[model samples]
Each structure stands twice: as C-alpha cells, then as structure tokens.
Target: MGDIIRVRGLEKRYGEVRALDGLDLTVPEGTVLGLLGPNGAGKTTAVRVITTLLRPDAGTAEVAGIDVLADPMEVRRRIGLSGQYAAVDEHLTGRENLEMVGRLYGFPRARARARAGELLERFDLADAGDRPSKTYSGGMRRRLDLAGALVAAPPVLVLDEPTTGLDPRSRIQMWEVIRELVSGGTSLLLTTQYLEEADRLADEIVVIDAGRAIARGTADQLKRQTGGERVQLVLADVADRDRTRVLLGEVCRSDVRDGETERELAAPAEGAATLMEVLRRLEEEGIAVLDIGLRRPTLDDVFLTLTGHGAEAPGTARTEEPAR
Candidate 1:
C-alpha cells in the first residue's frame, strides 16, 4: 500500500512546555495505525498537527499526497477527525448534526440530507436520528460524532480516543465500525490510551513517551521486543506468599507481587516450557500452588518496561486524589 499520511521532524511548543519534539510517523493506505502514549506524550498534539488544527514549529506533514503546511485546506478536504469528546450539538437532532456537518463540508442541501440519512442508517442511528443529541447516550453521541466525520467521505480518518469512557459493548461496537471502515480502504490514525484497543485494531503500533516516539511495531513485534513471556502464579494461601516468592526467585529473574493472592514472574524462556518447569518445582517443594500459567507479554508490560510506569498511571495533575 502507498503512504497516505507522512510526518517528519514535527515539533510543537507551548510557552515552556514542549508538546511535541521531533516526532515522525507514517500511515499506509487502507490500514490502521495505533498511536499509543500517556496523557502528556504528544498524541493529541500529533493529531492536531496532522489535521491542520495546529501548525508545527518544525518539520512537515503530508496527507493524501498534499503537504499539510503548504496546502492545509487540501489536506482538510481529504481527511476527517474525531477528537476526544463528541462534538455534536446538543440541541440538534442526530440527523441534523450530521447534515450540518455535511453542509459545512460544502455538500448541497439535498446531498447533505441524503448523506445524513445514509450514515444514520449505516451507523444504526436511524431510530434516534430525530431525537436531540442531549437525549442520546454516550455511545449514541459518539457514534453520531463519528457519523459526522464520515459525512465528508474523506480518504483518511484521525480518531483521538474515540472509545474513551465508552462501555465495553459500545467500545466493541466502535471497534467493529473501525474494522469495517478499514476493510473498505480508509486509512486511519487512531490515538488511544487503551492497549487492548491498539492490540486489536492497529495494523502497526507506535508507542510515544515524553514527546518522542520510543517504539513502533506490530503488536506481536513489540511484545517480542519486551523479551520473554509472563507467568502468573496465584497462591493457594496468602501465608505462602513469601515462600512462593523465594521458590520463584530460583527461576524467575523479575517479579511483581500484587497484594496477597497474585504474583507475576517474567521468565526468559517460552512461557509454556517455563511454566511446566515452575509447576514441577512447586510440586516438589510442597508449595500447593493454586493456579499457574504462561501468557504472552501484553502491551501494558511493554509500556511499563519502557517508561518505568504503567499505562494506567494517572497524569501528574490528577494524582493527588485519595484512593477509594
């Protein structure tokens, strides 16, 4: 596939804060590229630069063969963007919101209405099309927001945290919709905090940290780069935690204890073989293991290993809340 979006040496700064610093990215035609990062990692900044909402301090970006800096209007015409929040007008009906966006895109009134109806039906929003957006659920409003973006039928879509705060079922539904779009040949740049979402939807994954691209690869490739497999051991008794740790220390090079019931170990061998050996050792030691298994390293593991922080780590501003 040809490259539909290309960015190089992008940089952005706000006063003393450097939002983006020498970032680069590429998206092949008809594939989804997942952009993963923490809250302040410049994912949103990248999206803004690509969508022409904000100009970069340095570097260049191209969308659909048009240079974003040289011809931002042309890039805008060929791209759609859905940001973190649904941008629907609360007073407008769902259909009205989409039709309004279509008109803003320069579709004729008739064409806009037709397009709106088509998208409403396609997105399963037809039944709610006549209701005001304020009456819609979070999922419905999000679907409608996405429908608005597609009204222009752009070749490239930039979705920023499209599934944030959605219920599990709604997130799954949105994922299916994204798959359908990609299947029909739309190039997508999706910025998300959800590792599982990236693992499921992204053809390639880019991990960003502190305004820089730290890693990029397919999900499996990233996992492999993290090295080895994960072994989860759940002890039969909380009292055995210390003894279990000592026993695991023989074969496990790294371990994390979660409360009293669970401990995670990282082994340098393939998970299954290492798990079997560990189980044997436990049995010989009369450890009475309750559960044990081998599993592939998750995207979370990669994030933690790379940043010395978990993906779910709260932003600095929000870290002062008392734990419930």
Candidate 2:
C-alpha cells in the first residue's frame, strides 16, 4: 500500500517539554500503523499535528497529497480523528447526536437523518437510538464517538487510544469495529499504550519514546531484535529451582529468569544447540519438567530490551513530560 500520511523532522514543544523531537512517521493507504509508546512519548502530539488540530513549531506533515501546514482545511476534509475521551453530547439521544454531527458536516436535513440511522445500526446503537446519551453505557458512548468521526467518511482515520477505559469485551468490540473500518480501505493511524492492541491491529508498528522513533517494524521483526530463541521451562517441582537456574544460565549467554514462584524460568538461548545443551543438563540434574519449549520472542521482550521498560498497563494516563 502507498503511504497516505507522511511526516518528517516533526518538532513540537510545550515550554521545556519537547513533545515531538525530529520525529518522522508514515502510514500507507489501506493499512493500520500503530504508534506505540509510554507516558509522555509524544504520540498524542503527533496525532494533533497530523490532524491539523495543533500546529508544530517545526517540520512537515502531509496527508493524502495535501501539505498539513499549507492546507490544513483541506487536510481536515480528508481525515477523521477519534480521541481518548468520547466526544459526545450526553443531553442528546444517540440518533440526535449522530444527526448533529452529520449536519455539521454539511449534510442536508433528510440526508443527515438517513446517515444517522445508518450509523446507529452500523454501530449497534439502533436499539438505544432514542435514549439520552447520558444513559448509555461506556462502550455505547465510545461507539457513538467513533460513529461521529465517521459521519463525513473521511479517507484517513486517526484514533488516539479509543479503548482506553473499556472492559475486555468492550475493547474487543471496539477492535472489531476498527478492523471493519480498515478492511473497507480507511487508512488508520492509531496511538495506543496497549501493545496487544497494536499487535493485533497494526500492519506495522512504530515504537516512540521521548519524542523520538526508537524502533519500527512488524511485531515479529521487532521481537527478533531483542535476541534469538527463548528456552522456557516450567519444573514440576519447585525444589529444583536453583539447580535449574544454574544449569540454564550456563547454556544461555544471558542470565536465567526465575519466576517469583520458582517453578518456572526462561533464558535467552543462542539456538537449537543451546536448547539441546539445556535439555541434557536438565536431564542430568534430574529436574522434572512440566513443560519445556523454545519459543520466539514477544513484543513485551522487545519493549523491555529497547527502552528498559515494559508496556504500560491498560488505561494509564501519560501526562508526565520528559525534561527538555
């Protein structure tokens, strides 16, 4: 897919906080690009800049062949944004909320009503269409907000943590909705703290930190960067913990990771040779195994290796800014 969004040398600062520091990113047509990062990593700032909601102090952003800086109004016409908080009117009914957005997008009276009905059904809000939004559940409100963003059917969609506070089921529902959107050819730029969300949704992911692009690739490609295979073994008995750790540590170039309960451990192995060595040593040590396998690296490992931090828990609000 050809890139529909392009940014280069993007720089933005809030006083001493360099929200975006020489960052660059791209999103191809008909693909989802997950912007993954931790607290104060500037994902939100980048979204604001690309959507023309905030102007950057320096650098360039181009969307759908229109320069974001030079033709912000045109850029607005080509993109839609759904933010972390659901932007909806609690006083209005679900149908009314959608209609209001349609009217604002310049749809005529009759057409606006029709679009509202379509979207209500599309987002599974048809039954609650006439009820006040204040009575809507969290998931309902979020879906309504997303439906509002789609009122004008802009080509590119940018969602900033759309599932931030949702329950697991609600989050899955939102993911389904997003998948359907992208499958219909709407290119997406999703900013998220949920690595799993990014892993499942993004065709490619870019890990940002301290306003810089630290890593970018498919999930597997990034995971491979952390190291080779991982030899994970869970002992049947906790008594063999130290012996297992010592033996596994010798075969792996890295330190053995003992689980808190001491029944499991994992180590970075060089390859099959190391795995064979580990198995032989474990056998000699008479450590009974519940399970053993050589597994590929995960995104979590990638994050820890890259930034000295793991992915933040879901629903975390990242407001602390890195010192400039």
Candidate 3:
C-alpha cells in the first residue's frame, strides 16, 4: 500500500527542551498506526506537527501527498482529527454540533443536516442527537467529537487518545466504532497511552522515548525484542522463600524474589523442554513447585526495556489537559 503519512527528520523545540528530535515515520494507507510513548516523549508533538497545528523547527511532513507545512489547508481537507478531549460545544445539541461542523466545512444547510443525520446514526447517537452535548456522558461527547471530525468525510483520521477518560463499556464502544471506521478503509493515526488499545486496534506500533523513535514493529515483534518469556512461581509456604529462591536459582538464569509471596524468573529459552528442566530441578531439590508457565512478554515489558520505565512509573502522566 502507498504511504498516507510520511515524516522525515522532524525536529521541534520548546525553549530548552527538545520535544522532537529527528523523528521519522511512515504510515501506510488504509491501516491503523498507533503512536505509543510516555508523556514528554514527543507523541503529542509529533501529532501536532503532522496535523499542521504546530510547525517543526526542522524537517518535513506530508499528509496524503500534501506537504503539511506548506499546504496545511490541503492537508486539513484530507484529514480528520479528534484530539485528547472531545472538542464540542456544550450548549449545542449533538445533531447541531455535527451540523455546525458540516457548515464550517462549506456544506449547504440541507446537505449539512443530511450528513449530520447519517453520522448520528452511524455513531449510535441518533436517539441522543437532539440533546445538548452537556447532557451527554463522556463517551457520548467523545463520539460526537469524532462525528464532527468526520463531517468532511476526510480519508485520513488522527485520533489522539480518544478513549482516555471513558468508562470500560464506553471505551469498548468507542473501540468498536473505530474498528468500523478502519474496516471501511479510512487510514488512521492513533496516539494512545493504553497498551491494550493499541494491541487491539493498531496494525503497526511505534514506540517513542525522549523525543526519538526507539522502537517500531508489530506487537508480537516488539514483545519478542524483550529477549524471552517470563516465568512466575508462587510458593506454597511463606517459610520456604529463601530456600526456594536458592534452589530455583540453579535453574533460573535471572531471578527476582519478593519474600515468600512471589518469585519471578527470566528464562533465556522459553519452551516446554526448558520448563520441564526447571520443574525437575525444583523437585529434585525437595522444593514444592506451586505453579509455572512460559508467559510471553507484554507491551509493558517492552516499554520498560526500551525506556527504562513502565506505564505506571511516577511523574509519567499518559494524557494531559489540552492547552487552553
């Protein structure tokens, strides 16, 4: 497939901070690309540059074959954007909000109304379409915002953490909506803090850290880069903590012990053969084996290995309030 979005050597600076440093990206047409990273890792900055909301200090970006820096209007016409929070008029009804977007995009009054009706039904908000946006829940507002962005029916969609503050059910609903959009051949650039969301939606994943592209690949590929599977064991008795640790060390190459509660092992080879060897060693040493399995590394493991930090690391807020 052809590239829908291409960025090269992009650089952005905010005072003394280098928000983006020589970043490069290419998103193929008709696929969802997830931009994954921690806060201050340049994910938002990259989005702003690509969407033409902010200019880069250096380098170039192209959206749907149009230069984002030179032809921002053309780029805008080809793309739809849903920022972190729902950018909808609270006073307007959901239908009115979508109609307003269509009007702003230069549609006639009748055409705007027709388009609004179509979007309302598509987003499953036809019943709530007449209600003020303020009366809707977080999920409803988010769907409205997304519908507004699609008023122009742009080919490319940029969703910046669209499900950030939604409840589980709401989030799932939004995810389904996104799936439907992408299945209909709309190219998407999704920036998200939720690993599960990316794993479920993104065709490709890009992990950025400290303003640079540290990793990019499919979810399984990135997970495999973490080296090997994780082996977790639970001790039957708290008193067997130290003894078990020592005995397990003979089979486990690298191990982490937290009292008698849990012991984690990182095995170089993750297979049934290795698992059997470990079990035999434990049993031979008169150690009671509680449970064991070869579990694949999660995206969290990839994040920690690449950035030296996990998703829940202190001072690492995933989503920030939009700039007022």
The lDDT leader among the candidates is 2
Q: List where candidate 2 sits over 4 angstroms from the true fold.
A: 227-242, 246-264, 268-300, 310-324
Q: Which residue ranges in model 3 land beyond 4 Å of their true spot? A: 227-299, 311-324
> Residues 1-324, candidate 1, lDDT per residue (tens digit)?
679999998999999888888998999998999998878789999999999988999999999889998999899899998867438899999999999999999999999999999999999999999999999998888889889889999999999999989999999999998889888988999998877789889999999876778899997788777664667677767677777777666666555434222443334445577678778888887887666777565555676666655556622333222111
Q: Please, what is the whole-model Cα lDDT of each candidate in the order they appear? A: 0.82, 0.84, 0.81
Model 3 has a clash total of 0
* Better candidate by TM-score, 1 or 3: 1
Which TM-score value belongs to model 3?
0.82
True lDDT of residue 293, candidate 3: 73
TM-score of 1: 0.84
Angstrom error at residue 8, model 2: 0.9
Each candidate: RMSD to true structure? Answer: 5.1, 6.0, 6.4
- By summed lDDT, the worst window of 10 consecutive residues in model 3 runs over 315-324
